[model samples]
Target: MVTLMRKQFIIAVIVAALLAIAVTFGVKYAQQGPTLGGDFTLTYRAESFHFAEKAKPLNILYIGYAKCPDVCPMALSHTAQAIKEASEKERSKVQMIFISVDAANDTADAVATYAEQFNPAFIGLTGTKDQIDAAIKLFGASYMIEENKKSYLGYSIAHTDRLYFLDKKGRVRDMISSPRSSEEILQKIKELL
Candidate 1:
């Protein structure tokens, strides 16, 4: 009887230790922001584009579709204004990347054109479903494509409206959602710079 009680106690202790370890890792993960930025590659200008950490030094990433009528255009315009407001040195050290969540429709070239309309320095990227999904997971962003027969576009993507900021090491350092002003974005840019 004593042996049985002792074994139960030991099992409880082990379970408690496992739970503690899990909580520790969870907290660490929460502290560390998004991962897998360096390894993620998507198509840009008909070529595989990956972060040039030292070259760009900073990256502002926005995830949405080229066909997005409202949110994407405004957010990207706001981002462009913020970049324009930055000093030439600050602008040179940064690259704005638009990743199209609508992999099926937004081709690499199409995405590129969409981005350039806001700023010539801006870059746009798209990839196969799997590749886009990998990037989405890498940045901790989420999107859902829903078909709307009554809508003009036939389908619309409900995607994360946050702008993800990657530092010189290509690690996501911050994220801010839309409806944010140009001044707010510029402030974040200056802070990151």
Candidate 2:
């Protein structure tokens, strides 16, 4: 019995030490921030748009569908307001990217029209399931289309409401999850630019 107790104590100590090491590493990882976000290619204006090659020095990217009723429009409007508030010099260096997650209903033309409504310079993009999935993975964004026969649209999409802020090199520098006003967004843009 004594021997068994000793062995158990040793095992418990070993487990505790392992747990401590794991917690330390986890904290460090978080402190360093996420090592995600990158540029991705998709269809823009019925042509291939390589983000790294075509994007401006600063970019604001959002993932949603054109037919979205509330969240998407609100996000876009807020972003547009921010762009409009910026000086022409700042605006010249920045661009907005609207990526449609609802491929089933959002054709390239549809997304383009909707995106342009907010800001004529805003670039709308969408692609095949695989292409979109790859792009979404790069940004850690997600979306799902749900059937809602009872609703007028017959379906709805649940997606992340986030604006990814990218720097000149097409690297994600920050994310504006919910900006109280366009000024808040513009502030971030100015800082990054």
Candidate 3:
């Protein structure tokens, strides 16, 4: 009877250990966020941009246009602040890519100038209508452009304001929706790094 009880206790301990290991792994995986990716190519400052070829830097992609009056500016400001808050080592490992949704109005020079207003390090990208459409589809983002004669830019573009954080491997690891404080964004970036 004693030997049987000891064997049962050992089996129970083994099962508990296995369960703990599985739970640890599951939690870690869950923290990594959703898996989102597809072919995306664009032109940044007249240069070709391709994620697959650039293997090392963590890319934080923001989809908006230069003409955005509120959301895009705020988002870009917050992102720039977050990047500034990161340690120099951590900052060097990250890249902020702003893709213009208003391909028609946001010329390469315009996009570059707009992005540089936030941070000179920020890269601005835009493409032809078809290329922009393909990139939007790949990133699962939505945007709508409407004529606004009263506005200074002659039009308005409504687009998804969320920031897509892709890891060094070029996999979309996290999608930050809603506005987060610079500190909060920095923490999220650190975790992925």
Candidate 4:
């Protein structure tokens, strides 16, 4: 009986040690995934916006202006369709976000409306010019603003076309540039899911 009790005690100690090691490794893995949205604050069209509130969505941040002639809208539409085509379980794990590079024209309400047209769950964000510029710089996207004194607009921005994919843990994993098929983008997003 004494020997049996000693063996059980030893087993318990081993189990405890294994659990501690697993927990440490799990934390390390999560920390190493990606650090995407850690230092940015963007204003979106929502009743009340909080990044922590939308935890279940995969948190995709797209940087473009509402006035983008082609690339931005095309990419956003593709993203929406891709999410729709995903398996129900996979689709539920994604949240597509549009961040406006043109603060002068794109508003939270405008972004929200446009995003809803594609996917109700999609989010649109806009802020001050400085805020927009800061976000663009952080993402390393390049842009050129053209001044136009016509059509009720003073200026417009033309920018590089790129889509950034962030995992559910808010880490940027990969980027998809424009001039690529939506199918290709979908395949990439599917892998991340």
Give the number of the best model, judged by TM-score.
2
Candidate 3's TM-score reads 0.78
Candidate 1 accuracy as lDDT: 0.86
TM-score of each candidate structure, all chains considered together: 0.80, 0.82, 0.78, 0.71
Checking candidate 1 for backbone clashes, the offending pairs are: none
Q: What is the C-alpha RMSD of each candidate to the true structure, in Å?
A: 4.8, 5.6, 5.5, 8.3
lDDT per residue for candidate 1 within 1-193, as digits (tens), equals 9999999999999999999999999999998744645447789878988766223677898999999988999899999999999999989878898999888888899999999999998999999999999987877789998988877999878998989888766678777888368898899989988
lDDT of each: 0.86, 0.89, 0.84, 0.74
Clashing pairs in 2: none
Q: 70-160, model 3: which lDDT tens digit per residue?
A: 9898889999999999999988889888889888779988998899899999988899989988887766789988888998977788899
How does model 4 fare in lDDT? 0.74
Off by over 4 Å in 3: 1-34
Candidate 1 error regions (>4 Å): 1-36, 52-55
Specify the poorest-scoring 10-residue window by lDDT in model 4: 33-42
